[model samples]
Target: MSDFSAEETDLMDKHEHILSRRAELLERMEAGRQPPTSHRKQQEKEAEAARHRNESLLQDLQKIEERLKGRRLPAPSLLAMETRYWASLEESIPAWEHFLLGKGPHPADSRGRSPPQRAERRASTAQDRGLPPLPKHRPAR
Candidate 1:
C-alpha cells in the first residue's frame, strides 16, 4: 500500500510540472504572435508617407534645376530694340494726347498725317471700349 501511495504522489507531481511547463510555453507563443504596437504602426505609416513626399519634392527640384540649366539669356540686340521702342513712345506722346483730349491742334501740324491717323484710330477704339464719348470741350471759363 505505501508503495502504491508513493507512485500516486509521484504521478501527481509529474502532472503538475507538465502543466506548468505547458503554461509557460503557451505564454511565450502568445506573446510572440501579438501584432506590433499601435504607436509603432502609426509611426511606420507616417515615415512611409514622408518618404514619398520627399521623393516628389526631390523630383520637382530636379525639374526646376534642369529648366534653369537650359535657360537662354537675352541677347544685347533685345536691349537696343527696347531702347528704340521707349524713345518712339516718348516722341509720339503729343499725338496720343491730342487724340484723347481732342482739344490740341492736330498732332499732324508738327509730325504730319501719321500722328492724326494714329489718333483717329485710337479715338474710334476708345469709343468701342464701352467708355463715355470724349467730351467736346469745356469752354474757356
Candidate 2:
C-alpha cells in the first residue's frame, strides 16, 4: 500500500471488491440451481481440458529427453572446440575482405598458372601416394 500512489491503491481495492462480489454471486446462483449453469460448467470443462493438455505436453517432453539420452554425444574435446572457433572466425573474415580491399582493374592482374606439381613433388607422386606404376604390355609375334 505504501509503495502505490493513492489513486492506484484505490483502483486496486475496487478491483478486489468487485472480484469478491462476483465470487459471492456465482456461489449464490449455484445454490439456487438444480445443477450449476451451463456457462459455469463450460468454464470448468475448459479448465479441465487445459490441465489435460499441460499433462500431455509434459509427457511428450519427458519422452523426447529420454530419446536424446542415447543420441547425445560425449563431451567435446577443448582442442577441437578451439580449432572450430578460430576456423569460423577466419572463415567470415575472407568473405568480404576482397571487396573491402578493392577488387578488379588492379595492377598485379598479369599472372601465369604454375605447373600442377613442383619439380621435387612430381618425382615422388607415386611413393607419396603409396602406389607404384603397373608393368607395361608388350606385343606378341
Candidate 3:
C-alpha cells in the first residue's frame, strides 16, 4: 500500500510538471520570438504531440457529452449544425477563395460553356433589361 501511494504521488507530480511545461510552450509560441534552432525543433515536436493529444481528448469529450445527456444526438441535429456552419460560410466564400487560391472568381458554369454563350444569354434575357423576359420566343411583325 505504501509503495502504491508513492507511485501515485509521483504520477501526479509528473502530470503537474507536464502541464506547466505545456503552458510555458504556449506562452512562448504566442510571443513570436525567434527561438534557437534546437528550441524551434522542440517546439514543433511539442506542438505536433499536443495536436494529437487534443484530437483524442476531443473524441473523449464528445463521447462523455453524449453519455451525460442520456441520448444520442440525432442525425438531423448534426445536419442542422453542419447547415448552420455552411450558412456562415456563404458570406465569406469569395474572400476566402481569393485569399487561398490567388485566383479570381470561380467559373460560372461547370459544364464548360463558352464565355460567348454566357454573354449572349445575359444579353437576350429580359431580366438583364430590368424587366421580366417574355415567356415565349416570337418575332416582331
**Predicted structure with the largest TM-score when compared to the true one:** 1
Q: What is the lDDT of residue 26 in candidate 1?
A: 100
Question: lDDT score of model 2?
Answer: 0.76
How does residue 48 of candidate 1 score in lDDT? 100
Query: Per-residue CA lDDT of candidate 2, range 1-141, in tens?
Result: 665788898899999999999999998988888655897899999999999999999999999999998695656697789889999878766545654587532222223323444544675876688887667899998
Top candidate by lDDT: 1
Per-residue accuracy of model 1 over 40-84 as CA lDDT, tens digit each: 799999999999999999999999999999999678899889989
Worst 10 residues of 2 by lDDT: 104-113
Name the 10 consecutive residues with the lowest summed lDDT in model 1. 106-115
> Which of 1 and 2 is ahead in TM-score?
1
lDDT of 3 by residue, 1-141 (tens): 999999999999999999999999999997767667899899999999999999999999999988989976679989899999999789667766765695654444434787789888887785767986557987999
Per-model TM-score versus the true fold: 0.37, 0.34, 0.24
Instruction: Name the runs in model 1 displaced over 4 angstroms.
Output: 39-46, 49-57, 64-141
What is candidate 1's TM-score against the reference?
Answer: 0.37
Candidate 3 residue-wise lDDT at 18? 100
RMSD of each: 17.8, 19.3, 24.9
Ranking by TM-score: 1, 2, 3
Per-residue lDDT value at 54 in model 1:
100
* Clash count list over all predictions: 0, 0, 0
Model 2 alpha-carbon miss at residue 112, Å: 16
